[model samples]
Target: MDSIPNQQHAWVNLRRGEPAEALEYRADWPVSKNLEPGEALVKVHAAALNPAGYKLMKFLPNFVANRPLGDQVFGWVRSDHMRLTNQGALCQYAKVREDWIAYAPSNIPLDEVAGFAIVGITAHDMTVKNADLQAGQRIFVNGGSTSVGAIAIQIAKSRGVHVTASASAKNEAFVRRQGADEFVDYTTVSLPEFLWQRAEEGRKFDYIFEMAGVTDPSMYTQSDSYLSPMGFYATVGPQPKGLYLSEIWNLMKTTLFWHLPRVLGGPKAPFKLVCLDYQREDLEQLQRYISEGAVKPIVDSTYNFKDTLQAYERLMNGKIAGKVIVKVNIEDN
Candidate 1:
């Protein structure tokens, strides 16, 4: 692509602890430069909004100091000082690291492109890399109805692994359609009992992709019972905060009673609790998956660049069944 103009349109956050209503459209934020060799200045055709996008904005002020505190911020504010100022895919153009850009799948609609990168990378890292899933192995994915869950199921399926997933009753069919071999209704069924039954039937999983946070650590322990001696558990959610005595005691109980034995007696059981950092190579690999039809983007809705707040609102409502996207540049298409 050619060099972009000095100024470009972007949605900016004006203050902290406010809703999407606080975001504003700015036609003059500096069009970020392609400073590095491998970087590409993408004329962002579409961008996807993830749960983290809104949550970060709500909590950014508490995390970063001295930085402008508000909803109108955009892009990385520096590694340690990073804050969500207006960083969702709801804008006209974005200058992304070249390695972070991937070719949109021709099979998927252009509007759905934004939904793929963030959730896709998260699911890929959890299953293919963190869990070390293999063909014929069984894996359980929590939050099967989620965007990340949808992509993770497909990735595991493509690798020839059998999948058992948990979602609401309403999303059971959706989960199965995404290649889940088994579906568990989290609301109705006791997860541990269900896993125990599966184990009694001689069906044990090799990994547990714990997309849901520590709301139920016993679920992890129960799932561990059915894991092949050396299975792993990986989580992408935020850790609980404010160390209370009860919280510490609960943590000790879960660690000693549930997580310890799996770590000691069985195969090297790896449990991860960390944030995902995207790399250029991972983007390339994701592009290949898109091109080869191993994975597909799922979009729940799209908003025009001007209606960026509406996009964020829809994501916050939690009613969206797939990725929420923003069409950043209508004129270009």
Candidate 2:
């Protein structure tokens, strides 16, 4: 491996409230080249956007607001970030844990696959390993077009479970191509009522995956009303108050949270806040799923590394069909 640079470029969140107000690229951020035991330095090619800066950062402490924001990234291991190093993937070269690093399949393009790590593990853990969905069980994905929701849909389908998901009218067909059995135009119809109507028609869901990150419980909180007696309601948590902070309550009420999987909430149905807690084995399983073409990464749009702030701007604006990514410039690395 080539020697790591003493300084690397990265985008640091400049502010907290709105993503548009949050980031700026710095050319001289110090990057440690040394790797401790079990560390690997990666020459990052692409990094996918998770909702961290777009939504969660607004409620975070002052320190986190100005840090580099990113979780899942696609890159080759150069050295590992172990112990004192916490180099985020948004940089030119990221120091990552050796065990956490999973190589992107050669058959797929790296850009599309960059977003898979966080969302993929969360969705896979929820749909197959946690929910333990069966062949004939029915599921309703609240936010079908989300990065995690998209993967959840595919995982459920591959297991022979019938999948119902909600996406915008424009993206209804998008999730359908991903193997959704039913698509609800949440833009046009009352989602809970639609689920109730389906329940009335003997189409009750056995699993309710809430990828819709919203606080108004009415949007899906009572979803159990339409769920079967033994259904599982898995959600990462309430959508951070309206992604753009457009609504007043959205800005004030939003906080960081994750619903516990397998634990029963006050609601009748069991609900789990799906956290991305994959081991080396889970990472290996994800690589297998990708290699076999069982799961495909969805890239909504791409921006160059220098334009990362613009990427954050677009991610905060909402209404994207899939994950947003930033392509790092590694030509000189």
Candidate 3:
């Protein structure tokens, strides 16, 4: 392996406003000869493709003059900020900050570790940080089969919370394996109606993790009925324009009808909005979970480094049940 020439391969965007046709397959971009201080030179074994990758590239023309032109090949969240990097894991080797990298679990295959950090951190933030979930609480997860959803389920379960999750009928079993106590098929079931019925039955959740924002504000408005008094709602998906308008209206309604009672009359209501951010400590905790077999990597598929476009396409198609990883290279170490 030492005798193998040091070479790096990457999928680069050379032109603007083009689809996958704009990507340039290259054998060389840049490679670090040695690790800098607080850095580790890793032989990238795998990389997970997030849906944001395709959305960013497709919308690049709106943000930048050159369209899909940027050195940063991948975007990952670090704390509250989004970090862009040309040095994606879709190469033979990558130099990363040692602080940014978590020790991969020994039990999981090396390829699966690539997809762990981003989603793992997101899940940890939503369940532990934003929701402030306590043991024995009941929570609702809006999307059970997504990469982030899978991690959220495990994290919530580990904290001893009971999780009710929504997914397609086909993915119900898969989500159940991840630890969902109840399953709701969004295809056939009316979520808002179902939640209202549950509320009528004296059922409610302490927290709601909204991962599927496909129905705009309707999902939130409807799910609000299922929340217990003083519950929290954390969202990771983008809300539609109309939904944003609806949210403003709802806020106004709350301020007019509910706020006065809480402030002047000393009445209490249950509703809060939360947006999640990634943290290094979350990654470390998730790594421990993965290592201990409490959580497992759910990889939808693996593609070679050159097939990153295909991986991105797979993510955009909404067919993947879990994370999609790209194999950069195999390493003995």
| Per-model lDDT | 0.64, 0.69, 0.65
CA error at residue 266 for candidate 3, angstroms: 18
Clashes of each: 12, 14, 2
Task: Give the TM-score ranking, best first.
Answer: 2, 1, 3
Top model number, TM-score: 2
Tens digits of per-residue lDDT for model 2 on 139-230?
98988988889999988888899999998888888999899988889889988889889999989988888887656555345666788887
Name the lDDT of candidate 1: 0.64
1-333: candidate 1 lDDT, tens digit per residue: 354567778777666644555566788877656456653344556566655556655212100001111111112111232242233334444433434454444555566555666677778788766776779899888888888888999999999999999998998888898989989999998887887788889998787777655444666655556777877666775334436776666567555644565446432456666366667666667767877888887778867768767878897787667877677665743
Model 3 CA lDDT for position 280 = 61
Worst 10 residues of 2 by lDDT: 58-67
What TM-score against the true fold does each predicted structure earn?
0.80, 0.81, 0.79
> What's the lDDT for candidate 2?
0.69
What's every prediction's RMSD, in angstroms? 6.8, 6.4, 7.3
